[model samples]
Target chain A: MRTDAAPSLAAPWRKRRTTHYRRAEAITGVLMASPWIIGFLVFVVGPMIYSLYLSMTRWDLFTPPRWIGLENYQQLLFNDPTFFQSLKITTIYAFVGVPLQVALGLVLATLLNQKIRFLSFFRSVYYLPSVIGGISVAIMFRWIFGTQFGLINSALRVIGIEGPSWLGDPNWVIVSFILMSLWGSGSSMLINLGALQNIPTELYEAADVDGAGTLAKFFRITIPMMTPVIFFNMVIGIIHALQEFVLPFVMTGGGPADASLFLVLYLYRNAFQFFQMGYASAIAWLLFFYILVLTLLIVRSSRAWVYYEGAIRGR
Target chain B: MTTLPANRSFNQSSGQLKQFLIYAVLITGAVVVAIPFAWTLSTSLKTPQQVFTFPPVWIPDPIAWWNYPEALSSQPFGRWFLNSLVIVLVSTFGTVASCSMVAFAFARLRWPGRDLCFLILLGTMMLPDQVTIIPTFILFRELGWVNTFLPLIVPAFFARNAFYVFLLRQFFMTIPLEMDDAARLDGASHFQVYLHIILPMSKPALAVAALMFAQFKWNEFLGPLIFLNRSELYTVALGLRTFVGQEYGTDWHLMMAANIVFMIPLILIFFFAQKYFIQGVVISGVKG
Candidate 1:
């Protein structure tokens, strides 16, 4: 798409541009793309290179970086229980939250996929939280789940049940975070809705002719058909869940015994809070490695479960 | 038509019952989803004492319209709102113009290394921001962009968002190549072709990119939180958090009021441009 890709073999008859014309076009392309080229250098490549060095060193922003090969990784893996605890929370957040979020999205999308009315209205309502800032939503969640005067507690009182502290209680903080994760599940819901809409109506009609019931049709048809979309959402959800910072940071401050500290928050703390720049870089690398490993595992196993339309297996 | 017997009629009635059941379930779920926003609105109008009543005050006896002003004036919210607006507009413009320009370069122009560079640019999307954020902050600090809007806004001009570049590039490809050739046959150069031809035709794609970037910048937390530390320089997101601490200990009414105010722009933008937002999400989903 960029160049016709086989321009090197273009016949002389079709060649409208002379060498001068070609050189001029190249200059124009570089001139037009200069900003991105400069940004890719200053902002991206340079930083990544520096972080690679910083990852293996001990450097506070005030002092120069000192080389200490793999020491930060060694300590982060072995000596730091807080590191492990944060990783535990992060894993729980990624695994548990991703499944439930994907399930909720699938359910909502399926329901909305029915021949019901006012679908766009319902979709907008569901996706409202996702568009709002994490800070504001975090604030709203705190109020909704407040210990005494929250709506949840107030509703619970009507049913003769006492609502536990949502953000405050360590036991329920991550659960609270999961519920919050669902508010933004609308994006995936809409994505799933698009996929649902794309499923051929003929398939469902065929299922009906076969006397397949609704549940049977859903399991045998809809779910399998939705696997690609679901898998995409799952990988995305995993990455996002692992990196969740604002909600836990703003709501719980990773408190009530560091129960809600995510990988990014801990990294942010080490970098900015504690000024352990080198250690933070190391943490960042670990997270990067962790994501790569996890995604590779999913891609490796996707063959068994993931169903792609027109996709042939084993090449 | 022949009239059905009782068993067939029973099946027909059951079908009606099933429709009723689906509606019932959907409505219940809708209400559950909508309550948080409703409660926020209700709380914003409620009196301080009315906010936390055991029965949960559905409506305040007297609406405290003053809460809005009270919350707004409690801090430099007006300033923050302006700052956010300026930042969003400038950055959104920068992103669209620069991204579309680069997208033009990648999609239309045949330059050396075009495909190769594009692949590298697309690869940038996978590079985690966690790694890049620290060094960028340090770079900005050295440049004296710390505690200013420069660090937040400067990158937009550089068109650093690979997603948008990819999006516009994909969009530009959908356009017929003959359009460019026809424009070139005239006296127009590539820039003119981009300016007079591609852009006007690419409004839908450009609009989606702009709207999504606006929403993203409006809600953007981390960058603003890091770069703009001065109280007067705070964006609304940071301002709201700071207000939480500034008005500590059971000031839920004012807090809700502030939140509702903060949320108005987002809700309004979403309400008006629902199509673009949904399209953006769907586009990203499909691409991924």
Candidate 2:
């Protein structure tokens, strides 16, 4: 919303002055923006181009990078089982975990949206887990999912039921992470809450006058109105879940025969652990491609599902 | 008339039942959510024997306050805490200052390619950090900046955070243009106007950005995990991870103690500055 100093047509000198002012403003603007511009060049664009090049080459940290055209990509696609395994694992995690997280968030948000006492208290209690960093949460969950003395098992034992070793079992490892993911859905819940509040109560009131039941009003009005925010949360959540590294790294170490081996964790192992810079770069690019394609697909699908209140009002 | 009154009474009773049900569900969910934290705190104060007891001791009879000091002493937690403080503070300060400046340029200034630059910035946000991790590491290694805080700290000074910049720009747009025009008329330079008029007026938004950035930096793991190999240079997150890894058949009590210690500052920040946190989340959510 910047206003330019337009050159005055009537006064020749004023026009010159205006041009000078405009020039100065532009210079100042560039000066102010230079930090980010320089950063983008040195950090973002430069690394991206170099990484694309690196993806085709073979390099360990000690050796000079050997350029081999599309070998890394070919090996990753046709040769490596781990590559496909990591891809499948990450896909399932993001797709399954994000929807569950979004649904739970919506449910919690809907519950809290009622005219209630201690609204902030309930919100804070529920949202508290999300801000606690990943490592600590992972650490906490390692204990909570512990086989013998863990929180869940101990609770189960009281009812005479034995609990599974969550992190130890290959099948249960992903399930454990999924459960852990639920704890942090508070962030999405906050987002869902914000969307819920913005929804006009008049819609519900109008539904009430038409003799609609609670479920009908909710599904018909609230869910439709909330679709945009849900779409946003899903896109953000899926992208984030796809990059799940820290929890698996710290807790499971992508263990139980790579059951929890996420794409980024595998990428990290290749890059840092094995020091295969070139191959790791290939994995990174593949992960990026998946995220890009998934995000695009979601954005494309949003037209059918997402509801903008303004669109209806404008009509 | 009699039937109408009966129907009104039934509606009133049903409304009351609905309110009760809502409360019941909310309270039950809240308790379930809070249990892990309560378990952690309970474990932090328990003896090792108590930690493994069946039916799991919910409360310790004699609380072990010594666990905090004992766990902290086991690792170079003091050094790690200081390292984290330095990184989080320096980077957070840089993020707030640089982001606000860049945001001002985007929100208020007229320039060639300004809109394009902003669009590029938004585009970069979608590009996952993993995409550039390899080459960025190589670049840092070439510069001999690997195993140092430079990789973590330098980016903030250059407005590497597109989200913060976007947030601040959204805020800056809300400040009336008349204020800037008035400041300019009074012979204030663009920088002067940003410093005096915009920055001061944007305290709330600035505070939101700073708090969120600090939280992110303090919790950051991946950067330190990859860059800093030296134990002495470990941040709290990395240090805690190492602490957990160092011992086999991990001491649950000590681990819980360490976890709680790591979490206290963030918890305190949340309780005190929750309004900003919620506002930041809501703004990012609703707008993005």
Candidate 3:
């Protein structure tokens, strides 16, 4: 027993030396991550807590915060019609725009995945609108969707169809915003393209050997395998679409009778334009919860569908 | 398999038709994407009179090249251009530097609570900017950072961009640990390993992140819209808004011209870094 105890004691000394090395590594790691940690505390975490506190108070830029205690939430939930309208508009925008964008992106990616000439050039061309600033695209679409002398109307004229007033008419304004969003679906398309390329040619080869036609192979082999990537893009696209601001802000100005009044845009107007700081803070928290819940739901649902091919077999 | 010999020709012709149909569908989709940009250029080159012509000049008989110069000189175009360049460059550089450092730590270093810290970092991505905007605005105002580039540049230097950090971290993790072990054996410090080894190998990811950051910063409207008060400090996005005042209808021709100018840099960057962009995406996907 004494001999075993002596060896164990010596082993701990060796372990202590390794621990010293690990401690040194930990210190370096902390130093390296310090910028992010500091920024997180100062900019994100600190401000979030502060904003939560601010939401309970009435504070303008010139005045100190006065504790109102749930009044802001009360105003948002029951008193503000614009808040409800904005939520409705945002819901419509997210549901309509996100699905269209994702479907279009998948289609474009599938098309581009085929063996084709000038593939890179075409992709770059398609992706150009996305890299262009939101303001610039909004401005460009304003010209395209203009009531008079707009390019879209001119094109419609060539086809013997009269184009509707896109940004001017409340009925057509949301559609214009949707169109503007489609131009920037290139990023999601790129993601889909990457996912497509990764679909292990072997799987397709095996499917073909089994006499599966292209459509059959796509549905059976491609779709299931691509589910995870699709899920990722879907979640991200929904999140981004919910926060849609600049395009609607610059293009429609939340007008044509609030047709394009997104939640964030309304929040911006409330805080900046109307100077309703407390109310805006309340709107912000509500948005945060909305996004958080939606994200968690998606994540939860992903477990049943997102196939980890290797992990399942191994585990 | 031999029973279908008579139907083989039928299937062959159908295949040809299907192939042609697929091409037709894809070509139309491509055309749909391309037409808007083409229309923008065509409209920018047309005279304002021609722009309003009833039949509409699809091809301007005489291109209005003066639109570029006239549109530019009509406002502080040069200032806007300089302002955009300064902000984009600073933000891109700051993001690249800070995000790389944070990513390196998360990827390579074995530290206590490293996983927890990383989880927190990723969790922050779930928080929308709207939730933080009001508080960030107040904080910036308190710090006297409003009406300046500080709000844009300072946070970027402090690893404010979690998405980019996550992206870079994933890329960095793909690198062989043996490289770092070898460097350590050669007496290289962690900073030295980062500067000499990790960065050199992580060029593709860094370039992708930098280009993306530049594009985002260049196109950023909300941040500048909220923080920037004066027109002199206005980014291109904000500067374009000046043309859109309620007292007057927007000058479409000049606005389009300024837009063309604003897009040129991004267009060039996209074309040049297009390869890196695709490479980064593929690599990140494979690694994840």
Candidate 4:
């Protein structure tokens, strides 16, 4: 992670006759980054340390924290069915939503990458949903999926089909969320577009010469080359999906029978709404560990799939 | 070699077909994404009677420009707008200054534990913010910073945005080594080099960082919801939530109006800095 600039700069500084200049460089660097360091120590690191301590204590907002060792974690593991339910929901959501989004995004990006008219206009239109605030999107989805007088239902009625109450039904809430999420797939699409453009045209031409059809060329040439970007999007998508709160919070309130009760939503309820800070902190730590382990797994497995042209060349 | 010409004709026809398929798929995807936004714009301009009508109108019959002003005056929207503006401005400035500095350090300074620090920074990205939310809330409460803008604004100063720092570090690392060497030979200190040489060269990155921070802070609902308690201190996002209640009689037109108004600044900024935004994404991807 230490860039080449650092050592080269340091080597020259070490040979300098004046020590004042070196000290000044160090001082300035620290000064420039002080906000982040200070912020990290106070906000991020401090809270992280405190969360560990809080996990062992029962602390409401008004009352001084009362120490209760192992109770929160014990209750979460053994006693609470809601925690288990939330975990199940979140796992399903992450697995289902993340892959779908990534795949849909890649497909959309590939389609858009062709030499098409009004390319920028289409790109902007596709990206529109991403800029709309999450709450707004959720609200918009609420109207779209409304049981009575909804646009979706009306459209269904036009086709002589009955549209189920999407947000209202426990079985459909998660699906509704997943469908709503597709509107903002443009961010991942843009990233995929970048990866697609980086691919050499010669590869496609070479495939053409070899009589590789469109589908074959896409799978053999485009997909393998796009694996790294796909992996990147997948990891980020999982992380984002796992932490999904705003949409569910505004839309379903974790829903009719706790069907859409996401892990983070449950954590927020425990901490803010219910004032069980200790219990919430425990949930938070569990989530942190879950993400850490998952990311580590992805990173470890990346070598199997993620192909870097440069690394291949070096090899 | 005799079959090459026939193969060429076959390939050309297939390529044209493939192109046609691409256009078809892209147009459908674009429409799917655009419809919701179009619906919102149409809904916001509709009169209350027009909104709940049967066979819901795709466009309002008579445009209700009054809905915008009505939404503005519905709640403490003016105050909310000011609050959002203040927080976003402060946060963006803090993020840019802090992230750039940290990025510069990671890119240029050969300090002990720099690698460890950078790794830790990347590792933090994987850590769910939800895990930190409660502890951070408790910390804020302990410092009596809750129910104030301090909780939202203060963190920006501390390179709290590890993603931006990581991004800028990548950009800074790409700066030619000779530029720094030239600066050093000209009796320019590292600080001067960062300011005069690196800063100017990395304007696109800096602008990108600033724009992202602005969009993030402007649209932020959770942080403001958690920290700022009073109605007077509500951000535009927080205020918009007040439109919906547990009751069935929610004001659809007004809510849509507020949502549209809240989106204005973001849309304006987005259109203005789109070039830089695209550049930022490209650079981030390349670095990745």
Fnat of all models, as shown? 0.59, 0.76, 0.67, 0.52
Model 4 error, position A312 (Å): 3.8
In candidate 3, list every pair of residues with a backbone clash: none
- Report how closely model 2 matches the true complex, as a DockQ value: 0.57
Model 2, A26-113: lDDT tens digits are 9999999999999999999999999999999999989789999899999999999988988988898899999999999998899899
Q: After superposition, how far is residue B142 of candidate 3 from its true place, in Å?
A: 0.9
What is the Å distance of residue B168 in model 2 from its true position? Answer: 0.5
Per-residue alpha-carbon lDDT of candidate 4 for residues B1-288, written as tens digits (9 for 90 to 100): 012325567867766776777777777877777777678788899988888877778879799989999889878899989999899999889888878878888888655456777777886766777878887877778789988899899788877879899889888877877888898889897778888999999998899989877887888888988998899999998888888743247777788888888888888888888777666666555556
Q: Summarize candidate 3's per-residue lDDT along B1-288 as a digit string, tens digits.
A: 112223668768767776676678767767888877777787778776676776666677698878999988888889988988898888889899999999898887766777778778877876788899999999999899999989988999999989888889877867867788789879898878999999999998899899878878888889999999888899887888776643126666667777888888888888888887666655444444
Worst 10 residues of 3 chain A by lDDT: A1-10
Candidate number achieving the greatest TM-score relative to the actual structure: 2
Query: What DockQ does every candidate get?
Result: 0.50, 0.57, 0.50, 0.49
Measured by TM-score, how close is model 4 to the native structure?
0.94
Candidate 2, residues B1-288: lDDT per residue as tens digits? 011223667867777777888899889989988988999999999988788788788889789989999999998999999999999999999999899999999987778998789889988877799989888888888899988899999999999989999899888877877788788889999999999999999999999999999999999999998899999999998888865652237888898899999999999999999999999999888877
Question: Docking category for candidate 1?
Answer: medium
Worst 10 residues of 1 chain A by lDDT: A1-10
Model 3 agreement with the true structure over A150-237: per-residue lDDT tens digits: 7788778878899998888888888877777887788778888888987899998887567677677767877788777777777778
By TM-score, how accurate is candidate 1? Answer: 0.94
Residue A213 error for model 2, in Å?
A: 1.8
Please give the distance, in angstroms, between residue B4's alpha carbon in candidate 3 and its true position after superposition: 11
**What digit string (tens of lDDT, one per residue) describes model 1 on residues B107-212?**
7776878878888886686666787888888889989999889988999999888789888887887787778778888878878989999999999899999998
Per lDDT, the best of the predicted structures is: 2
Question: Once all C-alphas are superposed, what RMSD does model 1 give against the true structure?
Answer: 3.5
